[model samples]
Target chain A: MIILNILFAIAWMALNNAYTPVDFVAGLLFGFLVIIVSRRVLTREPLSLQSWFTFSARRNYPLLVWRWAAFIVFGFWSIVKANIVMARIVLSPQLRLQPGIIAIPLDITSEIGITILSNLITLTPGTVALDVSSDRKTLYLHAMDARDPDALRRETKQEFERRVMELLP
Target chain B: MSLLEIVTLALTALGVLFIFLSSVGLIRLPDVYTRVHASGKSATLGVVGVLLGVAVYYVDLRVALEMLALIVFFFITAPVAAHMLDRAAYLTGVKPVAGTAPDDLEGAYNRETRSLR
Candidate 1:
């Protein structure tokens, strides 16, 4: 596991008493070599190191963490902006909101992914996910301002949904 | 006393202001759906602002990191709670304001079966 490798590297660094970026990287390489050589011995199975490497590469776990961090930051900023929208709607004299229920189609296939996307959408001021379709292809949400459903659909797909897919995929 | 302290105080004030605005929104908004929008979204940011202020006030790496984790956890959970409220309110046939329109979800839900078409 990635965490295991990092832990092994940290242990190496701790033992060596050399706390430097270069030293940490060297320790990581040494730890990875140990894993590569002893993976089969540890697992007691005929495991190919190359296959494991490919799996980690495909999964991109480290990158996934970074993307999630980025998404959280971006999500916070968007929520702040959405709050401003709410402030405007609430404080305005005329109250010109067009609240309605509209179903936006789903690109995320996994249940977890859809739920995360729905949660993020619900956090936005104008949108709250009401329900998902039986087939799971559509997500019906209540929007406080639905002047242009098409534009909202495109924005959701581009902004929130894309980040969620990248983080989950 | 310091720059970080100033930032912390400013963030706390902003957070309290957001909380005040959310309450005002709750009072001014017309119906259930719009009211939820005002309360749920603004209140979340308000809490986040206050939490961030606390994190800044500590000025320690561990504290900051833990606070960041807490903020993310709060963000994820707060929306879920709000979503549950909105979903429950809608399913129970709570009516919206007069001008609410273009409801694509009108026929999709079979309330008797509580399933979507």
Candidate 2:
């Protein structure tokens, strides 16, 4: 497992085009830093092989390839949609915005799953993830044009949560 | 100015303007909750604009790829941090904007008849 982690770290650095001698030193330093930090930060439970595999495989091979393909298509579409929405808001005469925060219930229990969902929401233009409940059961999102909060919840649940569940395990 | 120079300058100016607005909004917004909105959203867009301008100026694969990575990392982390801050505020009973309408969370909680049914 440690070897796998090191190899993954090396691959990540290489992918970032950080392969010089100095970069190699920096990567080693970063690996050491991650270990030190994880020792302190990861106290809830020791990660098992299953968990590690789950985390690694999501990046390598998703369980639901079709869902991932859809996500890639949808993700690009969302980016275009976001740019349009942002332009409209910035250029609008009245700037008639109704911003509100809504709480979304999360079904996925894995930390990685939740983290991915939060990042996905943040990357999208119209919404931002405001918080996660301490119990990790609910996520708070602030939407720029929250016409109906229920619709926002359903949108999140359907668009992100369902795909995440399919991808994670 | 040449077209390339003009484009570069325009993008750089807009990027800097966004950064400035984000900083000002961070200060001018009413509360921490609102400030998060200003800083997180505006700054991400601001940095992306700056990076895009840099990519255009450099026009090299390595620099452009690095800029892309930076944008992706920024987009991923900014909202997660904001979410943490907002949740902390809410749990501490920070006052929300007054006279807001349609709190379904409250309605649902009130409608529940049994705690363990």
Candidate 3:
């Protein structure tokens, strides 16, 4: 299983198009280092393959496909919109910037889902996911031009969360 | 300059501005909690913006893929770090905002519950 994980890491790195012979060797060394470190640091009982694979498979596959589709569409649209807004901000003689942090309630429970949502928010033009509640129930997002907090929250809930939930099993 | 170069410059400028604002927010924001808000969130966007600008200028598949991976890795790690920091802060008794209402976690820890583990 550990070897598999190492191979999986290598494959992922390769897929990123950053892999070279040096990188592969470095990755293997890193993998070995991680093993040694985990042996010392993790005193807890070893996790079962079923647990690990199940967890990963449940969280990653089909969900990722749906999420990617949603992301491609939403991400392109958001980028174009963000470019326009940013252009306006840059070109305007008088900068009318209204930036604020608005707390957004998130319905997704999985850590993976929350991470995706937050990253998506950050990737979008003018918003950033500042902080989340201790329980991971609420996301605090900073918006570049947040004139209406409630509306932003509602839009986030509908556009991001709704799509994310649909993607998740 | 050509239209493409103009676009690239604009993106690069925006990216740099994001990085600057993030750094400022990191310094100016009150408290460790708020600083994390600024640093983690803004840094991710700043990096993404820069990468996007680079991708626009280069327009290569490999660069684009690498940028996508960086974005994914950043998104996954930032929240986990924030979660760890929040947990640490709570453990150290860092107070929330004054008007903050009852915390749901209090009950969970207080309960003489059966060991789910």
Candidate 4:
């Protein structure tokens, strides 16, 4: 493979009628592509390095980038909405509130995913991620006003958790 | 003024408003945990808004990237800080206000064993 790459690079430089460093680097890149393609064609099998170096994380980089943009936009709008809600709660003349910790079960099992979910929860209005259960099956969150626990749980799962799962997983 | 200036001003105002509201929540809320909610969430958003406003006003790629980096850093750090603060407050026996229901972790701690039950 090394010899093939070098030979292809030399051929590329000859064809281009240039032997400069930049042309050599470009030839090196072109050689890599030629080797990859010829290997696939000659062996009738996928490249060996493909299996080893294929990162699932990188497979959808463009998609992830777009989704990340969406997440940021959504997060910004949610922040605005949360701010308004919090302001209402704080500025209310009655001081009517129903604050408590609600245990939300986990669907995102990865450590990074859970961390993100918790961070997002804490940053959103009305909710603070207090602690993760010892078993890691549950996330305990404190809400400033969870008048209807079931609805809150549903909203969390549908909105925050779902989007986070899509993003991380 | 131009539309961009108007939008930047609006964003700045909103950001400052959220920051101010955070202080209000800090003063009005009942306990340490709730106060963490106010400071953690509102303050982070407020700073983001303010940074975004500035970013828009400048309209430069470098400025936008810097603002984005700042926002991400704030997002990651704020919650961890809030969690640590709440955890410390809880371990130190800071109780919630009167009639704050659903104390599920009430018996989850085993002080003698020095571990969570």
Candidate 5:
């Protein structure tokens, strides 16, 4: 489907005689619209065409790509904020802290999703996903400030876990 | 001197600050588990910021691509590395600092099968 999109984009460019990278990107967008409009026709064809970018048949590729890119950008922003928080903690005079390991029961079963979730947790400042249950139903993580584990759990379940499930499942 | 130069400098400085604080956390934090937070996350972020600054300053496609690749690689690997260190520390009985509690993972590890319960 991507190849088809690029081909369509190239054809559009050729027709318009607009050859800039920006124009190619615009052509790609137009090609995406074309693909969406022609998806049913494409799917009815033989196995060869259907096999191309197989996910496109079952899922909206544009939405998936958008979510993924949004997650990356948002994740980067969170890490920057986390660094500042860690910096404040480290630079502070008092070392008074309450730390503990908490288990977040896992709803995401895919190994890849679990892996990504754990890594995201690790990146978000204070939490490190130490391990998961053998049954793969729970994730064990260490929190730097375990003062409010309930709130933390609530936020994580609502935010990170849901997002991971969306990305993979 | 110029807007681009200023942005590059700011990014580089931010990266350096995070790296420095991570080092401080390494020295100040109580245990290995917590220390991993310092070393793993902030250091990676620092590297990311620095690389991004350089990429922005250079304004070359090749350089930007290389820097982006490095950043993505770091983002993927650093957390896994930290988790490994943490798991190793726990399995070896490197207990977390005092005041740690709710060991949900306790007794989950079996020596014979070497698998979590």
Candidate 6:
């Protein structure tokens, strides 16, 4: 499937007589259409989208694209917010902190889902995703401050994991 | 000079500031784990900010897309690298800073047997 897409992208570039990045992107866009049409004619089963386009169980590309954008923006904003807090901690003279590890239960099951969630958690300031349990049911995270564990967990779930679940599911 | 240029310059400065903050945390933080927390998040976000500035300055679709792709790649990889490092540090039994209560994984692994229970 991937090889076919690559071939279509190459074909698009050749037909257009341009090899620039713009042409590559244009080729990819064209390749999507070519693959969509050819797959239906060649095989009875639908060919799943790959690479930039996510493959979901429902095969809804449009919705996936929208959610993916939202996820990126949210993730970026979360990073900004985390950084501000972390900077405050670093600059403060007192260095008052209650750092500790706590188990954050997992809601996303797939390996990709778990990976994405863990990575985002680590990327967000003040939180580091330590490890996943043997059964993959819980994620252990280290926080810069866990004076209020419930609030920390709540924010993580609401801001990071919730969006990740939406993106992957 | 223009609104877009002003925005680009601001983002670039913010990005540099975050990168600087990461270093500050690295120096002041007590432990290796905490240092990772400082370096990982700020560095990734810092680079992303700089890339955004570049993308904005270019103001072309292809350049913007390429920059976006770079941001995405950095975002995805940085955390994974940090997670691996953190796990390796933990399994090797690097202790946290003093005054931290209740080491949860203390019982989860056997340092003598070198195996996780």
Tell me the tens digit of each residue's lDDT in model 4 across A1-169: 5566678788889999998767877887788666554654443545576743453443333345567789988887877777778888878887877888777888888899899899888878788888777666788788888778888889889999999988775
| Per-model C-alpha RMSD | 5.1, 9.9, 11.9, 8.0, 4.7, 5.3
Worst 10 residues of 6 chain A by lDDT: A51-60
| Docking class for candidate 5 | medium
Best by TM-score: 5
> Residue by residue across A1-169, what tens digits does model 2's lDDT show?
2453466568668877877655655665566556544532343335564554444443433234446778767765664455445544554556455667677888989998898888777656667686665678877676766778888889888987887777774
**Residue pairs whose backbone atoms clash in candidate 5:** none
Candidate 2 wrongly placed segments (more than 4 Å) = A1-80, A83-97, B1-7, B17-35, B103-117
Task: Give the chain B TM-score for each candidate.
Answer: 0.89, 0.76, 0.73, 0.90, 0.94, 0.87
Q: Over the stretch A14-63, how does candidate 5's per-residue lDDT look in tens digits?
A: 99998877788899999989877666566564446554456452355566
True contacts kept of 2: 0.21
Candidate by candidate, in order, the iRMS in Å equals 1.4, 4.8, 7.7, 1.5, 1.0, 1.7
Kept native contacts, as fractions per model, are 0.71, 0.21, 0.04, 0.55, 0.79, 0.50
Candidate 2 residue lDDT tens string, B1-117: 877677778878877776676676665544565566666666666777888888888777779889989977877777778777765665555655543233323322212331110
lDDT of 3 by residue, A47-114 (tens): 66444344343334334545667677885566446544444444456645455556666789988788
Show the lowest summed lDDT stretch of 10 residues, model 1 chain A: A54-63
DockQ for the candidate 3 complex? Answer: 0.08
Docking class of 4: medium
Model 6 lDDT tens row, B1-117? 999999999989989988999999999999877888888888887898899999999989889989989988988888887788877888887988986644566666565654543
Ranked by TM-score from best down, the candidates are: 5, 1, 6, 4, 2, 3
Q: Which ranges in model 5 have alpha carbons more than 4 Å from their true place?
A: A1-24, A39-58
Q: Clashing pairs in model 2?
A: A130-B83, A131-B83
> Comparing 2 and 6 by lDDT, which wins?
6
Report the candidate with higher DockQ, 1 versus 4. 1
lDDT of 4 by residue, B36-92 (tens): 888888888789889999999998877988998998898899899998897667767
Query: Quick one: ranking by DockQ, best first?
Result: 5, 1, 4, 6, 2, 3
lDDT of residue A128 for candidate 6: 87
**Residues A36-125, model 6: lDDT tens digits:** 656444444454555324434334444555678888777778888878888888899988878887787778898999998998888777
